[model samples]
Target: MKTIYYLFGLVVMAVLTLVSCESKPSLQKYFVEKSQSNEFMAFDLGTDIIKAAGSDNLSADQEKALKAVRKLNILIFKSDSTDTNVVHYKEETTKVKSILKNGDYEELMRVGSGKEGASINMLGENDDIDEFVVFLRKDGVFGLIRVLGDEMTPTDVLTIMQLVEKSGVDMAQLQPALNQINGNKG
Candidate 1:
């Protein structure tokens, strides 16, 4: 009886240890997992794509910002009241917010209100910015843009934005995806 009890205790301890070793799911992991259901569209771009999109005449600030950016992950979901995934969307958004709240992320900016909301948050130490998360919700559609970088600053993001605006990247290309999310067969 004593030997049997010791074995049972060892099994219980092993189970507890495994449970404690599990790490929290990251934003990227959530995006990838939930996207498999076809409720969201995921776009991932590397540094090379960003570099190629810009002009050769990039300013010093723009160059610095572009170089600092290592990767970009975007997930867009169009609100469909009739779809079952709407529940998942709400749950996933709450999870993301909870994760951010528990971390050292700081709000950089916020715009709009009510049903339309947009915010930018950053995670970093001191002057070195590590990640920039942009959450935008408008007209029943939601979008998340995660910019991962090394030693980035707020000013660097501004410069990169300006470069993107001038690069003639077709903004209309995204309209079809947005329309699909809105249940508009375009």
Candidate 2:
């Protein structure tokens, strides 16, 4: 009887493990893999975004929204020249698009076609959001911004966008990518 009970416990544990394991490709896995390559530049804007994003002249709601954010994962594609860079840019862009389109994320907004466009996607329920993803593709360059938090509300995300639109994200963090993109354009 003891042996039978132990076997049953083991069986239940195995079943639970199998059920919890993720089988499909995930955006996070892609981020890790691409970050190692020379073609991509990755940055983590830590929890202290108030400092990084420049908290000057922000409203109460904006400040609150910014505080709700935990961190941001940014991945920008880099190339030496626009003429020669289309190969990897398109490839990585396609991978990101595929992940977002097929994954369980909900789309907030999308515009443009394959050559140039932008998209915003979110994961989790309406009230308790887990992560927000923003993808931008233009001028033969592309970038992915993953906003990670514990339980950000939809209003928080909207206010954050408003804050960014009004004040813009800290340019220091994005300067390198901007420079690289400009250089590639020529």
The candidate that wins on TM-score is 2
Clashing pairs in 1: none
Task: After superposing candidate 1 on the true structure, give the runs of residues whose Cα lies further than 4 Å from its correct spot.
Answer: 1-22, 47-54, 83-85, 171-176, 182-186
Best-fitting candidate, scored by lDDT? 2
Task: State the local distance difference test value for candidate 1.
Answer: 0.75
Compute the lDDT for candidate 2. Answer: 0.81
The CA root-mean-square deviation of candidate 1, after full C-alpha superposition on the true structure, stands at 5.9
lDDT of 1 by residue, 4-104 (tens): 99999999999999998768766766777867867678777665554335367677777798888888888887757655656766776667677667666
List pairs with backbone clashes in candidate 2. none
Off by over 4 Å in 2: 51-64, 79-85, 165-168, 184-186
Lowest summed lDDT window (length 10), candidate 2: 46-55
Residue by residue across 99-152, what tens digits does model 2's lDDT show? 999998999999998588999999999888999999998876788999998779
